[model samples]
Target: MGTTHDEAAGPRRRSLLQAAVGGSAAAAAAGATTLTGQAAAAPAGTAAAPRSGGRFDGESPRFALAVLPDTQYLFDADSADPDPLRATFRYLVAERADTNIAFMTHLGDVTEHGTEDEIELAADTFGELDGKVPYSVLAGNHDVSGSDDQRGDSAYLRAFGPDRYARMPTFGGASPDGYNSFHTLRAAGRDWLVLALDWRVSDNGLRWAQRVLDDHPTLPAVLTTHDLAWAEDDGEARLSDNGRRLWDGLIRGNDQIFLALGGHYWPPGRTVLTNDAGNDVHVHLTNYQDRYYGGAAMIRLYAFDLARGAVDVETFAPWFLTRDPERRTPLEAENVELTGPADRFGLEIDFAARFAGFSPVPAPEPRPASDVLVRGTVAYWRFDRAGLPGAADEGAPVADGRVVRDLSGHGNDLTARRLHTSGDGALTWSAEHHVGQPAHASLRFDGGQGPDRGALLSTRRDAPLNATRFTGGYTIETFLKLPEPFVGEHAWMGVLSWEGRSGDAGKTTGWSTEEPTCSLNVSPERFLQFVVYPHVQDADPTSWSHALPVGRWTHVALVNDGRRTVMYVDGSRIARNPTQRSTGIATLGKPFVIGGTQFAERYGQGFYGWIGDTRIVDRPLTPRQFLTPYR
Candidate 1:
């Protein structure tokens, strides 16, 4: 972790998510390039771009790498000034401190037309950054002079040849035309190599990328191409033309290449897969070139903060200077409308920890759910094993690391997808605390941490768990114990929620309202609450009931039987709300979320304590059936 800015004032670590951090050190400490780069800048008649929100300390060992997706808009023939593109580089120079920005990568499409003027625009803008910080660029489909079939990026090479990057310590080698290359850098005491390839890599080019990885076997690698992963309707990512070939031919065997990044396919998507060697490979796709004026000058920031055991990702457009409307024109000049959750969020990934035996691969075998009381269990998670088969394994299972095992007949297992990608080892299984009734382990969720870092379980939305088409009453139950010190805090905490996105449950869906199937929450006043959307608003004064006992094992359950809804605590009715004569639960399009919902605000408000057996049945349980004693 980096030391605080003012150590003498009082030793305190800077806020991991807040606190703006850079501006080219004082004149005396400014490096030669920092001074020369800004001095040589052309007068931007327009207002300056806004400062990026991401910040870091001047002396922090943690670093960030900025990914500048498709800059084809900067090369637009209709543009009055190429200020957006220029602003991106300037933003880097301004926020250089907070970011500890080690490198910048352009995911190709640097030009709309392969003309000399456009090429120079990119070259000159990047040139200003040339001496200050090392950067690399990959060729996109639009980078060449001719159509796709006649593609050739000779101009791109001439502008960014070997000579241009020879001084960079990490520069490994590049193709003659500079369409393919690699760079090496260090973060969190680990070495990394970034390989850049053309829009469509040839067989020879693939071999070159492979050879680069072969030569630097000790270094982790990130491959940048023009087009790779694309989003699918099912929410899973599928590879494109070049992507498929690269994966099968080059990436499949290379254990060193952990991340494959690309642009060109719009609507960003990400997926992680385990290679033949059991190493987790993360593939990410980002492209804003088709949105407002070719992506509204947005850039992706990958902040690797090992101290927090997570990677904080942010998307900010330094060029979208909206504070001063006079300068905040959408397309003509600086963009003004691009800030949203889709563009910014922290993903829990602690690469440093993962590199140190924090394997992303699941254990080969995991324990199955133990036979116990309470029939009609449609989905369950014991958190006992660490393999895919999990609680569903028919054979005797072996305990691996921590895993959220789904004991339900349906394999609706939970996984920390975002956290895994960002490199955090998600949940760590604990045997210290649990309701030993079923003789199963539990999971401890540490609250008030970074985004989605709380104790939560995420399972993919599948048919068996798809509540969207259900027409029956339902029951949800969980055993949890809150820590003694956590009850009085005036912050909302989540118990369980169901939806597509992460945290809060209720969300708008199309023309019709899609209330969360249900949400089990703990209010700021320590009250156990149950909320059903559409029929019940979140702000309803009666959303909650009496206070729950603190620091004690408690079993909470919610049962809806076609009309009225009743809440139970430790097998006793605690609260009830009579509802209109309607179907008990609304079908949801998202997955079942345990411990937390997908609402962004309550992202870190996960239950802080031990969560024992959690089970959900499609039908409501009778009072007697619900309180059955455990063996």
Candidate 2:
């Protein structure tokens, strides 16, 4: 059985039933008992807003999972009021497209009593989501007669049995007793499992859950139940006795179970536990029945951003949102959204690495040089040959004076050169490369300012690339990642640039005459800056990009189609591309440099990051022709 707590322990917990009906008294008096009662309360002849159907984007890297917890207080047998719950359902249905809500899961305690009247009302209210959103529900202690899934023939089971979800695409299966169920939602290009377990699951139920895990061994799972944990005033949650039992019998042993959610306890909280596989399992308890207006039908949205490897959680009361802001009471306004640490927060999980044990994401193999040698390719340099017989091993210092052959057959080979005062460890070979990069290795630069220390690879004094200017157009592509704690001293470091000064090229329109004719650099704020001095025009057209996230590999491309320049990061065109004409690059007969910029023919600092395969083309190429394949 779920742990019982006082619903009205203090003045703050007193019921707001009367206050909630202040302006909507006429609607409350109408006593409309259907799921659409809230809509019926609207003006005559107006139909309820349409629900979002067939709008979910399951393959999006970013999506949301809606969680409704403990609506028991709103479904009491005689005082039943389904308006609040209906309002929440409407909100989820309307925002489904904008939020990319893949699925909804109700943490059980759907009614105040185990009576047929209450369960029936609750079930009817849920009809608002019947065909629109896929969801799962289970029996709470309040909705069952006895303490286990084996307890037969309850109102909750009769209303939410396998028959209720047999037609749903996400429904996987239900236990024989129809009290425990599992759902498989296709999201983020993969299948995810949601286990809706009874408040008191029997040993037989646990065995059934194990079988489900065995059937789909690769799907990450979220275990949901009614009774799991209780939180203290400070919002630190501790597992209840029943929760401990579930952990021991089902969750802790299953490597695929990464998140566990429950709602029987008040004062929502969360904690992290280590499973037998030594992976983290996030255990969360969310419930607000003790709050004003029976918790106001609050819903929690877990926004999963796979690219960022994080889940942003937000709790808000949709019922309050449906109310008029100008007529809302102070309490109603306060309950609209929750910003407390325990209620709203973010969880970071490296999805690929976390699921690697069960579903390993294969690393892309290095592409052949011939594959990326697109038309008009002038230069292509890749460090993937590291660990070869004559090359530096992974993580080993790049030897001074080592030569890197240009794969384009352009005879523009580059040679590694260490700064006069820098140490041998200034640069090293790294096996870490972008997931989509053609190469599987990169070069790590440990350069810094204040003394101008680092190593760089530069073309020979007479290399053809240093003298040829792309009059028709040009494309420069490179995959790079900034250090996690990019220090202040490493600000304004250069990733790649031409070696000659703009002044030397006779082009004076630039941030500085001493600066390079063309350069790609990281500003102090980590913004990507692409500046070029055009040969046909004296104006320097510069393209600035949003701040790049540290510690994540990014593919950057600068495409100039003879007229204007556009910068693309990870295949998406940035908003700050310059409109000024940029016909051709101004060049001097000097060595082109990578890993550092030159000011008046002097290196101030080398790049403090990892640089992967780089390619330069004399003609502007589409994203499909870039080294890193665009998705």
The number of the candidate with the highest TM-score is: 2
In terms of lDDT, the poorest run of 10 residues in model 2 is 31-40
Per-residue lDDT of 1-631 in model 2, one digit per residue for the tens? 2333433233344232222232223333342321212332233323246445448888889888888999888988778789889888887887787788898999988888878899888889999888888999988878887869999887788899999999899999999989999999988889999999999999999999999999999899999999988776566778888899999998999989999999987778899999998999999998888778878789988999998899988777767655555455677756766667787789999999888888888888778888888989999988867322254577798888888889898988989988868887788888899999887888888899888888899999989999878889999999999888777597888999999889888887787899989999999888999999998899889999999999899999999898988999998899998889888889887888889988888888888989988999988888887787665
For all predicted structures, in order, the TM-scores are 0.48, 0.88
User: Candidate 2 — what's its lDDT?
Assistant: 0.83
Model 2 Cα RMSD, Å?
5.4
Q: lDDT, candidate 2, residue 162?
A: 95
State each model's CA lDDT, in order: 0.60, 0.83
Runs off by more than 4 Å, candidate 1: 1-61, 77-80, 145-153, 232-236, 322-342, 350-353, 356-631
For residues 1-631, what per-residue lDDT tens digits would candidate 1 score against the true structure? 0011134235544332221222221211221122112222222344444344454343454678888888887775556257666777777867666567877888888888757777777787777676666788877767675432124447776786677788887688886545788998766556678998887787777777777877887777788888776753233467876689889988878777777888876556677877767767878877776566566567778777764566666665555431233333334222232333334445665464444332243322323354543566777766554323344322222232324556665777776432212223233445533333243556656554444345456666564575543246667777887777763342566777766331133435322233344567777777887766433332222245677666767777777664556777766676445453434444455666766744532254456666767777767786565533321
Count of backbone collisions in candidate 1: 13
